[model samples]
Structures are given as C-alpha cells and as structure tokens.
Target: MPTHNDPDTFTFFPVLIGDIGGTNARFAILLDAYAEPKEFPILATADFATIDEAIQSGVLDKTSLQPRSAILAVAGPIKGDEIHLTNCDWVIQPKGMIRDLGFEHVEVINDFEAQGLAAASLEPEYLEKVGPGETHPSLSRVVVGPGTGLGVSGLVHARHTWFPVPGEGGHIDIGPRTARDYELFPLYEPIEGRISAEQVLCGRGMMNIYHAVSKANGTEPVAANPAEVTALWSQGRDSAAVETIELFATYLGRVAGDLALIFMARGGVFLAGGIAQKILPALRQPHFRAAFEDKAPHSELLGTIPTFVITHPLAALSGLAAYARTPIRFGVATEGRRWKA
Candidate 1:
C-alpha cells in the first residue's frame, strides 16, 4: 500500500464520495475532475449492516459507474484503520474496503470536516444569512451543525490553500447564563457528571431541553420526540415546546459564537444540519443573534462576524467533490487518514 504524504501530489479519479452520518449515508460518483457528481438515493444506516453493504446495494448495484477511489466523511473521529461511527452501528475499515471492494485508494474524514469544506466552497445561493454581517474572503470560518449529534469544524485559509480542521468540538462544556436558564438548566441530565454541548444541542438534546422545560414549568411532557416537539412549537399549541426550541436556538448561537471566537472566524460562521434549516424563523429572531453576540469583551467583533444556514441538501458531497476536482485548492492533511492498495 502506498501512503499519501503530500496532498498536492495526490490524485484519484472516478471517486466515490460519501457523507455518512448517524442516520443516513449519502453517496455520489465523480466520474472525472470536470464531471458533476452523480448522486445516489439516500440510504438509511439501519437498512444495511455495514458500510460496504449499503454502498453495494444502494449505489454500485444501481449504477454502472465503477469508482477507483473512495472518499468518505463519517460522523466519528478518524483514528487508525477501524472507524466506528459515534451514533451509528457502521464500522468503516478502509483497508478492508480496499480488499473487499477493489478500490485503489480510500480517504476517511470526520463528517463536520466535510461541512467545513462546504462552508468554504458553497455558493451564495445555497446559504441564507441569519443576521447582518459580511464574509471576509480567505479568513478562517467555522461550521456548526446540530443534528443526531452536534458537529463542529473550522476552515482556515493559509499558504493560498483552504484547510479544513477537524476536532471533537461538540464535546465542549456548556452552561447557563440567564435567570430562566439557571432554573431550567439544572433539570437537564448530565452525561457522566457534567453536560457537554451535545447534551443539549442535538436531536435527543431537543427532547432533553423539552423535558427540562416541562419540569421547570410543572407541566407534563406532551412531545414524544424531537419532531413532535418541533411540530408543537410550529403549531403554537404548547408553551413548553416553544421554550424548548427557543432555548435550543439560543444555545446553538452561543456555541457557534464561542467557536467563532476560538477561530476568529471572520470569513463567517455557517450552520448546517436539518434542525437549522427547519428553524429558520427562530434562528432569524433577535434572541439567537443576541446570545451569539453576548461575548462581552468582543461583542463588537462578534457582531461583525456573520452567521448563515447551509440550505443545500447534499452539502457534504459537494465539499468532497470540490476537493476531488481541485485537490490543489485544499490543503487536506491525509497523512494517516489515507489508505491505498
């Protein structure tokens, strides 16, 4: 097997790009550098036992396209050969994939890293600005997504190349600020002993907040799941449900803002995931932006940094496609992540 030490010298054609999350695995084929990605139907991770099984049944069997290289963005940290997704049951072994699926090369990356790549490369039409600010080209940017789990990554422009920095930012600590927050926050269940950002900022996190809000209000929790809670909020029937989503947006803004400060994301802070796209009106409200700009010493700097929601459905694939097409434009570190046969 040949290791890819220099990203600039790396080359792969007929690439199979995937955005594998906890729930769904989306795949696409880039036949060549100039060809647009040909996407396959979204596959539920539960339907197939392994990543290769899903790809074979959902993608390879359906099309005549044969890809030589695979680029997968998974929802867990890329460490060693065997990759177990954080929330899903799928375990991705790149070398095993090369051995079983006949691929020449394989690259595995964190799911949010793909989101960061999308944020750096997506067009204006695919992004909806949440507040008033402008994007400073070539500056560092952050992408935060609240979904099955909270995903966070940073995109930095250095040495005339855009580099996506992947980390477990979702596991960062989060706390309450306001009086109402103080009352409700105590009710939230802690993972281990303390609450991380993912504890109150994801799909199950919405339920956590809902139950907490219900307890604080001394009301019975009516919503069964995150979707029902969002539905109740949308129908304007349940006050607790409303508070749940509101708190969710507020906390999301706070986290996004914190990441912005960490990276000094002057390029902009982009929000991805289904929740952000669903709660557009709530995110547009003053509360979200207010919490985001609450950074006291640098509130002015926060205000100048923009926040946006990624609207495109196949965003992660787009990012992989961009990197596949023009590898020189991105300085992706593939020293340990890339495998070959």
Candidate 2:
C-alpha cells in the first residue's frame, strides 16, 4: 500500500481518476495516498454533452473531494492534446479540461493502457481462470476485451519493473481459419472491404454475428441489442443466439491466441471489459479453448500460457490510482505537468 508521499515525492493531491468508454464513464477520487478510490455511479456517455459535463455533473457534484489533478483513460487514441473516440461521439481535449474544470494537471491515455497496468498486479480473487496454464512473472502478459469496442494491450516485465505497451491491435484484419468462419465471415462484408477484429468482436460486432446467424438460418433477427442476444442464449431458447455466442467465444479465443503468440505473453492472457465478465460461462465451453489452442505450429507453446477473465469492475480506475501514487511503479509513459497551487 502507498502512503501519502512527501511533497517532494509526488506533485499532486486528492487526484481524480476516470475511465471513459463508449458506453459509460466511471470516476473515482483518491483522497489520500493509501486510501482506496471512492467511486461514483457509472455515467452514460450519451447523457452528457461533453467530457467535462459528465465529470462535473456525475462526479464533482456528488463528491466532496476537491481534485487538483485528473488522469483519465479514454476509449480512443490519444495524440497531442485531442482525443477522438472511435466508437462514441465525445471528443476530449486535455487543455480544455484544465481550463474549464479548474484542474491543475490533466493527462489522457488510451483506456487499454490503464487496463494493462492493472493486469500487472491483479489479485487472485479478482481473476477467474479460463484455461489451464501457469503465469510466469518474468514473461510478458496481454489483456484483451470486447465492450463497446475491442481493446488490446500488453505488459512487459523487465529488470524488476512492468511496462505497459499500448496499440490499436483491435484494428488489425481478422482472418478466418475455420469452417464456421468460412461460412460466417463472408456475411460480414468488411468495413471498407477490410474486416478488423473489432468489427466482429465488440458490442456491435456481436450484433453482426447475431444477424449473420439469423440470415444464414433464413429467419428474422430477434434481439435488438447485444444484451438481448446474450439473454436469448442464456435462456437457451434461440438457436441463432446460441450460435452467435458460440462464434463470439471461438473468434475471441483465436484473436487472443494470435495476440498471445505475437507478444509472447507467457505470463498470461487476461480477458477484460463487460462482455468477457458477462459471458464467462459461454467462453468456458469447448469451442473457445479448441480455437485458442488450434494454432498448429505453436499449440504446444500456447498450451503453457494461462488465460483469465478480469473480474474486478473498476480495474482501470485502480490502475490510474497506482500510477498516480508512483508513476514509475507501473512504468507507463505518461505526459503531464503538475499544476502549482
């Protein structure tokens, strides 16, 4: 646990940490160095006009803590001072957040970066094992998830430190390698004729699978959203919904296996985000594991790597708190200057 550091040790106090996604934004206040983050209710992104509005209305107004600095992990690419979400309409600017929100310092990072940091120190109780394998401390680890969008990141451990590597791996083209995929993927005409993993892995992606399954069956689609599709699968009443989830698990496993191989994540492959947590039962089925280990040339190598589902709800927030305490601990490269009081 990190105690409140001396002024010389850290430059901020009572910092605000946030995880903003396409669907919801979660806020928490770190009042002291060692205290747990006090979280507020999840705010729907569509309900607020801007990021500042969401923070002011949903966080600052509800809490008594006065935060001088804020570190937000947003669901988008972060370049310069502007952040434009790929899935949502909100645009975030760090300079504007400082000027209008009266913050002394503001830092924005890709949401999966935070998740990767958190993956470095997740407690055993917060994780549910997905397959058999061991996690080695000296090796690298990967975290991938599907929510409003797909997110991919990795943590590399070296010289007694963990470093977060963020990338838009989700945008890479997804190649079909199975019988179901051969039949299903053609139905998902690639976005601009090139299909990325996210197009068939995220929330909207699941809907695409559902619709594709329904069309293949020559039946009308029943569910209106991802949740409804999952509900139908959970009830075991709709064959198309069941097939949709089965495909989701299988494709996710393939993607995870590919990423694990790419990063050589011998430490583990952790599944994060809302969808993974909700669909754990489906993922545990044989289709997922079979696809994950189907890499013929490296099946033996992948079999040694563990896979898990991150069960902690506010993992990104916890990672931000860890970074705020000692930025060097997580070894994530962040850009921001401390504001003078």
Report RMSD for candidate 2.
Answer: 3.0
Compose the digit string of candidate 2's lDDT tens values, residues 1-341: 22123343353778899999998999999987788888899999999889889999998888777898888888887776568887788998778877888777776778998999788877889889988899897799999989998999989987677888889889888888878778878898578997799989999999989998898889999899999999999999899999999999998999999999999999999999989998999989988778888888999988889999999999999888888877756665554422222
Question: Per-residue lDDT for 260 in model 1?
Answer: 97
User: Each candidate's root-mean-square deviation in Å?
Assistant: 1.8, 3.0
The models' CA-based lDDT, in order, is 0.91, 0.85
Where's the lowest-lDDT run of ten residues in candidate 2? 1-10
**Model 2, CA-based lDDT:** 0.85
Report backbone clashes per prediction: 0, 0
TM-score of 2: 0.94
lDDT of 2 at 307: 93
Error of 1 at 21 (Å): 0.6
Put down candidate 1 lDDT per residue, 151-268, tens digits, no spaces. Answer: 9999999988888999999999999899998998789999998889999999999999999999988999999999999899999999999998899999998999999999999999
Q: Give the candidate number with the greatest TM-score.
A: 1
Query: Residue 72 of candidate 2: its Cα lDDT?
Result: 84
